[model samples]
Target: MELEAKGICFRYMSKTAPILNNVDFTLKEGDKLALVGPSGCGKSTLAKILAGYIRPSGGTVLLDGKPLPDQGYSPVQMIYQHPELAVNPRWKMSKIAHECWTPNDELLKDMGIEKEWMSRWPTELSGGELQRFCVVRALGPETRFLICDEITTMLDVITQAQLWQTILDIAEKNKLGMIVVTHNNYLADKVCDRVIKLTDINHI
Candidate 1:
């Protein structure tokens, strides 16, 4: 499978300048691509478009030459930089984690998710701990592409390394396509097979 973004354009408001213009890229199974650019360069905006979080003003995001599904579980899943904002505050960690699918024990272990934490609320966990759940939740078997938008930016080096290792292992095992958006060049080099600069593709 392949995820392709073609001629994508986006703007926050009609009166404001476009944030992304004519951005394009493709990611296929087993393909790990890093998107790098300065902050506010629309790297995150493009990632959202690809993940079906927002509609592009003037283009298409296709999965395997067809439009992404509008209903049911999307083959594309995105893990955000802030896990707290992504989950529901009213639910426990177990409910949030199982909202999509019940991740196996082995997967949870690899992600360093404690079984005890599952009974607690999001507010009870540290940022690093919350992020582990976010990562595992996005790795369901149906996910064919994963968009990671600076997902480990708030963590320490040790936690970041552990999370990345688990993510890479899971992606490889599932043959999932990955788009990693970040400003960290070292991280891009370490995790991606190829890199695309947002400025190079976005004309805004």
Candidate 2:
């Protein structure tokens, strides 16, 4: 499988300048790509566009040479930087975690998710804990591609390492295409098979 972004472009308003301009990239199955750029360079926007979270002002995202589906569970899934913003505050962790597909207990344990925390509310967990749930939620069986937008930037070093390890392991097992968006060059180099700078791809 291949995920392709062709001539991608995005802007806030018609009158405003485009943040991404005619950007293009492709991630083949089992490929891990690191999207590196400074803040406000449209890395997050491109990630959203790729995962169908938002439409680009121009261009298209293709999965296996066809446009991404407009409905149903998208093969492309994204995990955001802030897990708190991604979940429902009122739902229990179990519901939120299983919102898409149920992750096995072994997978949950690998992600450092404790069973007791399943009954708690989003407000009851720390950012790292919440993020673990978010990651597991996005890793549903149908997910073939993953767009991670600074998902670990807020966590401590140990937590970051642990989460990345689990994610990478799963991706390897599933042969999933992945895009890791971040500003940290070292982390990108460490985790991704290839890295691209957003500024280099975005003409705007």
Candidate 3:
């Protein structure tokens, strides 16, 4: 794993609302880290920084003790709160899954999703199914780390629990590092090895 951020700073263009200031953290292999804070506290911003989606105004982000790439996404992938929004409307579920991994009908069935659903469009599937596919997509080739941004926010409690367990199991099996960003402390306790409160980070 080996992720770290030193003296990070970020601000939005809308206002001087400094989202992150001098944020510092480290995540090693098999680390299940949770970033928790109130909305607008910059938890998501920091997550973006970790994933190399956004650059910090100051400081550095490293992976395996080396600075992360400047352009293009990191090997790290993200699972968002809404899977439907993440998938393309025109592509069939099978296509989406294939883009992530070789088609394995057995795996789909084991995920409690029928193989027949593979031919269906994103809009044809239920929310949970869509999200399951979204997770699969992010777990595709080259993915070593996952930045889960409140991924279960759009699901029901039962679905959330099931998905969380599945994700944790997958991460452990694959030795994948994860940074889970959520405001829900309870969920954090259930999923993360250690939790950090974003509000505690200092700024310049």
By TM-score, the best candidate is: 1
Give the Cα lDDT of each candidate. 0.93, 0.93, 0.80
Clashes of each: 0, 0, 0
- Candidate 3 stretches greater than 4 Å from native: 70-73, 103-106
User: Model 3 over residues 107-188: C-alpha lDDT tens digits?
Assistant: 4554567778888999999888888887877775466789999888877898888778777877887788899998788899
Candidate ordering by lDDT (highest first): 1, 2, 3
Best by lDDT: 1
**What TM-score does model 1 achieve against the real structure?**
0.98
Q: Candidate 2: which stretches are off by over 4 Å?
A: none
Give the residue spans of candidate 1 off by over 4 A: none
Candidate 3 Cα lDDT to native = 0.80
Candidate 1 backbone collisions, by pair: none
- lDDT of residue 134 for candidate 2: 92
lDDT of 2 by residue, 1-204 (tens): 999999999998999988999999889999999998888888888888999988999999999999999988889999999999999998999899889987898999999999999999999999999999999999988999999999999999999999999999999999999999988888999999999988898897
**What is the RMSD, in Å, between candidate 1 and the native fold over all Cα?**
0.7
| TM-score of each model, paired residue for residue | 0.98, 0.98, 0.88
